[model samples]
Target: MSIVKEFKHVNYLWEDSVAAKLAGDEVALLIYRSNLLGADLRLTNYGGGNTSCKTIEKDPITGGKTEVMWIKGSGGDIGTLKRSGLAGLYVDRLRSLENVYKGIEQEDEMVELFNHCIFDLKSKAPSIDTPLHGFLPFKHIDHLHPDAAISIAAAKDGRKITQELFKGTIGWVDWQKPGFDLGLQLKQCLAENPGIRGIMLGSHGLFTWGDTAYDCYINSLEIIEASAEYLDQNYGKKGPVFGGQHIESLDANGRKRQAAAIAPVLRGFCSSERHMIGHFTDDARVLEFINSKDLDRLAPMGTSCPDHFLRTKISPLVLELEANANLADIDDLKEKLTPAFEAYRHMYKAYYDNCKHENSPAIRDSNPVVVLYPGVGMFTFSKDKQTARVAAEFYTNAINVMKGAEAVSEYTSLPRQEAFDIEYWLLEEAKLSRQPKPKPLSGRIALITGSAGGIGKATAKRFIDEGGVVVINDNDSNRLESARTEFNTQFGKDAFAAVLLDVTDSEKIVNAYNEAALAFGGVDIIVNCAGLSISKPIEDHTEKDWDILYDVLVKGQFLVTQKGLEVMRKQALGGDVINIVSKNALVSGPNNAGYGSAKAAQLHLSRLNAAELGGDGIRVNVVNPDAVISDSKIWESGWAEGRAKAYGVTVAELPAYYAKRTLLNKIILPDDIANACFVLVGGLLNKSTGNVLNVDGGVAMAFVR
Candidate 1:
């Protein structure tokens, strides 16, 4: 095995060639510098920082060049930043806001003023840090929340340490929330410290500046590198970290097993206010800190950086279990979650009650975004998969910050009142209000069998459009890879996970579900969409044909659903299972004994499972459709010709013939079946289960009596 290595310093990625190409363009050079800084987490976390450049642009009304400050906009990552993602504002107009800035009490009123100062009519929305950048004297500034910079900024004696480490090269300012007031304070600090290159905001982050882009980028990296080296020199000098690691970490496979076993329950608990997607990690650092003695003491202090707390909430909820717990201890861990969660809510509400300002927005969700397990790993939950994943990344940043501060000096979190004020600030509430409402299935995860193409693909796409995550699968490797790429492109990388495996193989089924558990928290809806067909008269039906049909249709659904139960049952949150049965399950005909009987078995299996699993809050239902010819694998696999032969019609006429026979004369399609599946599980008829919905255009014989 190869030894793993850790990077101790942020790399200098500036290339003179790349900069030379954009020689005359200041805004383009600014974007290039921002991307280089953002490419490394050591510089700053994803979406955690902002960068800026001040250049002269022609005033729309004046017909003259005026100073304009271009800064990173509200919600995009700096690493992937583009010119359009910047909010270009008139610096003169921005600085003019001091005329009406009625002191700290009226600071929030300043946000509205920034909109009136937009230089380009199409500029992106400005962030709260706009004033911080516009008021600065430097031509280029980097306001980054680098984990290393934050470590020194968050220490108990941070200001004193700043004086000692950089010898006044970087000055310090006491903590104040970002706004008009903080901007003025920064201006004052620069005035007091002659020849200083940057100002380190106490318990927040560092602000570094330079006359040119390269100077600014290099200055930022140099400070971060020094901070990291200082911490590395002193870490554990006092004693072994976390009192010498009281509990041992589970082995690699056991860590995954334990993480998967309890992810669903943790996800459900975190979804008390709204459904949530979950992310799990057992990185060595996470395991190291979680298994330590100080886990209980340090977790409650909350994060010092506002960027960290904004995504992770004030603090994480710790789910404790016996020392050295392994996969067999999952039941005990599950039992601990309920009490731990309930207590966490109580704790958070009390914090709000104690610290909320009169004008603060109403209390938001009390559920912890991050959860910690002593012998296992970390789990983070949020309204979407990406957010949850990012929350975990942020908490990991917090852990690193904590470790660094503790090593060099006492680690101090933001004061309680300050944390609350920043968390529930009114401006933040307004920003949240402007966001679009979540789709009905925003936080759900569905696993659809045979989703490489056809009905399965359509159904998965529908679920995804409604904001559901999916675990898609097919036995065909080529089709599965194509579907994976297509979905990843159309929806997003986080929208779906594709697995290639046979449904009838139990080992493969178990392995596939494990992948689903890790990709998402677990499954909340399971669709048995994999199927095949065989058409033969009773006399001509050979045993091989019968076995193949049953194996692919009946046995396949049973095996897939059986494995899904393990995940759903543990979640304890009510779930939905939609079976894509056929109308032939109810309406019998000649030359279709093998396929039709298997469909009937599938229908009965749904009913039986509904009866058996209902006590566990699982609803099993069937969607029976006929003649769904468009994009159907079953139709393409010789079933169309066989059905046409039996009906004494050409293959091309099957759709018209089937539609004509129906009362509504509607042609059934894969999309129609997809809609039916969505109807059953999309929270429309939550109370109705053990039922069959016919998407066959009013087939009277297929109707349930």
Candidate 2:
């Protein structure tokens, strides 16, 4: 039952070879072992665990050897840990400050002392659990909130049961907010129980240590494996099955469609003044937990551990759908679910009022981070997709822990006061407080058409960089896929979604909007950037060329804008729409009848939408850009050379020729146009609508009055 010995992927010899070359071999080994532990989701979720190694580092300046503990730094996850992610603190200095803890009445001051003990001033702040690692005599330590361990740790009489299962190989500590006091308690417990190899903190997690990283890691694996084995022998088959006659009628895709249909409504209801993006998951386990009969009794008990409180509020919102309600009718579902969310908010306010201390920060927005719908699985919501995903992961793990514990006896979590204390603890809050200020459109979602390259791509990147989630759309599948990969790589995998479709097709446009809604709850801004250019004299222009230009330029803008308006209305949040028209709309030119007329009409359509949607708080605007032909697809389709020939310049000199003609004498880049889009959509021009912001490098002929 030793999982580490049985793990076939890890090569101890290779790890030793790599660690042998490092000056701080213990630190190097710690990093390698931390990564291995992080690779398994069963061992850690996101950045939930910490690891440390005690070693002696000779001071470069003083040439004196000093004991040091290199622990995983705050905000660093072991999965991506590097040398920089581990903070090196002088253990002697930290132990010397033990007297300082007596006078430290506030937890924040103790945290300050922890930072003060760092040997390298430039190193990241040490993990808050540094004292625990430093006080232990072991050379290596690993602490994780593994699901299997928590199943035993969160059970009723958990300490007694864990003692029975481990047979005194592990010591138990009562749940305490992780701080100087808890660290001292752990050190005292280990001193009293000299033979214990590991310790389980009731209602929290486990800590294992040994003289070597391999020993510590293997001990953790064995402890976890033993916990799993115990649970399997005692309660594996006692839990209720997930699906029965209730969900048998619907197939997998049908259930997914139901979840997709209801996610936006749930998002809208859960969101406060600012919108929240919903991440939907119906993984078999999630479905089982949501569909379980004991959901009402078990779901409200709170997070399995205090670490999850910040991400997924103390408890999830459990909603029971009407037995005969229609899932396909979104409006009807919204009507039925609105009161449940309102009641959840009311209950949360009451809980905060009763449990919060006077020094506690103001109550957070009362919207639930996790929502449980009987037949529709679960929906986790947050300001962005990444946090939502993390919440969903932790909640899924919580379900496993709860089912295992329930099967044994009854699952018990930390009391509500303890959960609230950790949630609002100043030390815990300080971790997030260190983040930089958010951008203007931090929580907003935008859908930009033609985002594969040029102005559309630039605009999408700008939105993402400024803390907005964007759904990139384009008719070019290859380019769209490439752009998606590039954006996801630069930002995060959850930052962007790509939909390949023609904006001119009404049916496809509607489906694309639906796809965007499902991906990021709903759209907050819409950028109509899909278009082409055709240069032909009025007499030479054929009907086919005119139709093609009109369909893509004007009709495309109309269809996309209309669909965006519908989504915005459903969300009941004010939105912005930026139509990427051309300078030809403001100023006419010969041999530009097809392109110019269509753009001019598109500009008019924006004005009409602005007029109609003003009362709904939807701002409609147009960005008129010119001479951005260098990387645009329109130029690659033969329009660039033809336009250069008409202007009496070579294709290479076309950009300069247009630049010199403008009053500013500057080459207008796609990024410049993207900046204008940001200003209009990012609330800088909140009070203005039905207006055209020109990014044409100050074209005198195209200046609007």
Candidate 3:
């Protein structure tokens, strides 16, 4: 391995007056900041890394003075880190220890150090690398198995390979278990060459430190960026060629198609952008790693580092492709994928059986983190979007490292049990246990009218997001197709349906509802958002306009609710009906004779239904939205105007205007409406019914009767 000379890195975050007493005001800030840095770096995708700060402290009870250490508490993300996230430890205890009392079998030693060395027994387990970080002489130390750094390190004869690429610049370390023994080894190596700038952990990561914390963070970033740049320069390739089978381009239509596909996946996975599926395919690494076969083995070593280890575990699916192959067809893709998934589960169970505590919860499901379908490439899954995206990046980086390591010698990873222990660790198990799955709505069916617009669509999305299946209906065939494509794409076929039928037609409404129940088992909720408006003063109101408005706004709602109540009461399963009315119903509005009258009727209708359906356990409510603008008549009319008259000041500007009308100065969106629906049917409002909820932008404060 090539070792580079050390250089002095400047760290601006440290105070020169930092005192020897640990937990003192100045040192407390330093320690807190150091933990923040560790959490930030580690919380990054494939960025399982650690940071530590050394300080001297006086023991309060014993009245004796000693050096103390504080490290990142185990099990939390750096992104959400605070002062409380740190685990307190006795530095003197660690520094003075001559030798590990327990024999140094890697796994056992790691557990012991974590349990004994850390003074905060109730806190999260100290990272397995605490000993290594503690052994370093630097006051501020940082270690990260950055995807970028490890990707380069995992190359065959990585020392020589990287030497050729980086020259005699980067320091290197052969892979070693991270604990007391490794700590001692690093202490000796640094002593031999005190001038080294950083340590490159072979098949692992890179380390950088300074006398202060700022230098440590910046140094780590610089080294990682350098490695990333090197790979981009040497190994980067153009986008994959699909053999002229017409993979969609990232155009407007392409984006719509992509959104549809992605939306369903998000819904089915019960993930929000912040939860599990966000950023899943946003990174280049997802695409690159999906196209490779390095995910076959089970090892806690992971794609890159520890944080992202949960994303892809240490294994992904491996697939091989012939000269001619098709990746677009779902059936063809599944043919290659199904068996691989089965094998991965089989292997995962074996690993779990070998590693975990006997009482540990059995593996819930055997879904591979990364799916490598050879010709079709690979994909990654996680509990959240960021995690999945980060894992994908780590896999790409790891693939590069593994390929290089293979070039030097056969690239191999740790045994199955070790990875299983890390993957199914008690700490991680706790995280999974804390997540409360969406209830009551999970697997239930709901039908939403006017679902192609903001509120209806948003409500449908919310229901689907909460694990309920939704059948979205719209009069406009185009909009219906759009909703269908969007929901199907995001939730897969399991969570969504799109029907093109106008609610004004009573026969059609009944038929569609029957069909939806037939298709998805049974219906549980109905949101009547399919209403029409006619802006005309009483004197100017036409017979046609009045009739059409009443037909859709009042008649349509009545017909659908009537049919829905009948079906719901027959099934004897309590259900819900939400009517989209208007806040303007409470206060009068000019040029809204037909629309206002119809909405007023719809509101009273909801109360009547609520009173009648109470015994059947059905809930009926009205949502009076004042000025929420989505893909609706107002937005379309404004867009079609093309600015000459500025029909409604453009769809984008509508929110600000609406917000200004509200006391809170807040413009509500579809999601706000969805959240309200979540509360209503979510069984939180179990006792109340015949109520009108206002989702308007503070237009009026009068409660619905």
lDDT of each: 0.87, 0.81, 0.60
User: Which ranges of candidate 3 are over 4 A from the true structure?
Assistant: 1-47, 62-65, 76-82, 96-100, 104-125, 159-185, 188-195, 214-259, 262-304, 317-361, 371-380, 396-417, 426-540, 543-676, 679-705
Stretches of candidate 1 off by over 4 Å are: 1-8, 15-18, 323-334, 649-667, 697-701
Cα lDDT of candidate 1 equals 0.87
- Cα lDDT, model 1, residue 241: 76
Tell me the tens digit of each residue's lDDT in model 2 across 1-705.
212255332222225455456535788889988988888878878888899998888976689998888999988898779999989888988887777776436655777888778887768887778887888878999989888888888888688888899899899998887877778878999998998999998878999998877788888788888887777677546535422224422456665666655666777777765678878777777777777666777778887687676788978998777423576665776787788888988988888888988788878789899987766677899978888888999998888788668767678877888888888786777776888877787878899999889999999999988889998978988998889888878987898888987987988887787777667777889999998887766787889999999999888888888877777877777889999999999887767888888989999999999999999899999999998975688987767776877787899999889999998999998899899999997766899999998999889889888
The lDDT of model 2 is 0.81
Q: Specify the poorest-scoring 10-residue window by lDDT in model 1.
A: 1-10
Model 3 residue 683 CA deviation in Å: 6.7
lDDT of 1 at 425: 86
Report, for all candidates in order, the number of backbone clashes. Answer: 0, 0, 34
Clashing pairs in 2: none
TM-score of 1: 0.94
True-structure RMSD, every candidate: 3.6, 2.8, 11.7
In Å, residue 82's CA in model 1 sits off its true spot by 2.6
Residue 215 alpha-carbon offset, candidate 1, angstroms: 2.6
Model 2 regions more than 4 Å off: 1-4, 7-24, 59-62, 103-108, 239-249, 322-331
RMSD of 1: 3.6
